[model samples]
Target: MISQFFVLSQRGDNIVFRDYRSEVAKKKDGQEEAPPVFNVDGVNYFHVKVVGLLFVATTRVNVSPSLVLELLQRIARVIKDYLGVLSEDSLRKNFVLVYELLDEVIDFGYVQTTSTEVLKSYVLNEPIVVDAARLQPLGPAAIFMQGTKRMPETAVTKSVVANEPGGRKREEIFVDIIEKISVTFSSSGYILTSEIDGTIQMKSYLSRNPEIRLALNEDLSIGRGGGSIYDYRSLSGSGVVILDDCNFHESVRLDSFDMDRALSLVPPDDEFPKRDNLKLK
Candidate 1:
């Protein structure tokens, strides 16, 4: 369980804070940077950085480190979904809104719901949009833009609350397939180990919240000797892809997964990893 939650700017200014049980002491000034998870005077702290802001949670009892970190990330995403841009200025301008979100997201140190759509009904304050154009770009791209014109439109710069001229909400969803490949070489330059970690990320802005159907490659095989028809083709080297293992989100339905390699589900309001930990043979 979380005892306290707060947000701090890069300069270490406390932007937003909520103390549920008061089990942890108040943050002191000029606190040095620490690991994502650390202990202080018997209290444990879990934090994650997003858009130059630190989202932190403190607890006194032993809890899952991954769970708390994921909670922090989800909270940050929910805030960004409402504020459009997630910066120190945005959190400051939408103080009330941020508090309302925290209140709904966690009740008395217990997480209730982190979904942005679910919290929309409880949070009434409209977010004060931040000017993305005036803010400096993050990462290596900032160096290249020293003398260039304004940056182009990016996903982070768009506000979810903004509607069209006729007050119609945009209906769009984005899916990104990201993969990281790792290889280890021996002393003789021989490949000792190779693997790929992949995930399917999705973000939805559909108002009606309709069910979505995502179809995978027809020649996809789940394992080396799976019973699927694609398994035989894969063994024959007929341009078939093999996945040693894969995992899907809880919202996914697998009724048609074995037959056609398709997934059906109603996506959440915020961005999330729909499928993850895909291991290729």
Candidate 2:
């Protein structure tokens, strides 16, 4: 069971702390209780560090030591996605997001969703960036609906050359299809085996819970091309892409994928990566 969670700076100052139990936060007379010493006689403390901040989870019960450690790493990733950077000042400035994420990840010291991709589905807000010309940083709640912080004027012009003057380019997410082709050949050059391993990597900045449909030319049949609905005639007629041994993020509903023949997703917000893998013959 988890007793407390803390985000400590490199110097060990508490950037943010939360007590999961009510008694830990209050005294017998109901006055506020002081912070617990990180090292207690019987408790075990697990720590994970990322980008100069330490994430600590303390517990008194018997639990998988590795599990608590993994939780800290996942928590840090989700926070990094939200804040774009992790540091003493960044966590301090974005304390609310940290608290909100910690609550969503662990319920009363039990591990909940450790998938940062899934966690991003619940955590909506992102850190604020401001006008670059003035080089002034805005307050944390300031929303930026336009493109990312200023690119070089030349780079910006190059990106939107097709747009009419003064038309800003839409900030669309980028999806990367990475494939590693595996092939074998005898010294005589006769092919023995071949397969394709691939993954779809997405860097998203869409609106809250944006639904996406990814259409590919892959010939998809519940069974095989022998199915009357997708017979050899049709398979040979249209250019068909073939996929084998595919996998998807847990958020992807199998029923929808089967019905639509499209990869469906509610994409995560800015800079979060969603990866799905597949093998093709």
| TM-score, every prediction | 0.79, 0.49
Residue-level error in angstroms, candidate 2, position 12: 4.7
Candidate 2: the clashing residue pairs are none
Location of the lowest summed lDDT over 10 successive residues in candidate 2: 153-162
- lDDT, candidate 2, at 218: 50
**What TM-score, to 2 decimals, does candidate 2 have?**
0.49
Global lDDT of each candidate: 0.81, 0.59
TM-score between model 1 and native: 0.79
Query: For all the candidates, what are their Cα RMSDs to the real structure?
Result: 5.5, 12.5
lDDT of 2 by residue, 38-71 (tens): 3445666678777667787777776777877777
Summed backbone clashes in each candidate are 0, 0
Error of 2 at 260 (Å): 10
Off by over 4 Å in 1: 22-24, 60-66, 131-153, 225-237, 276-281
What is candidate 1's local distance difference test score?
Answer: 0.81
- Score residue 111 of candidate 1 by CA lDDT: 97
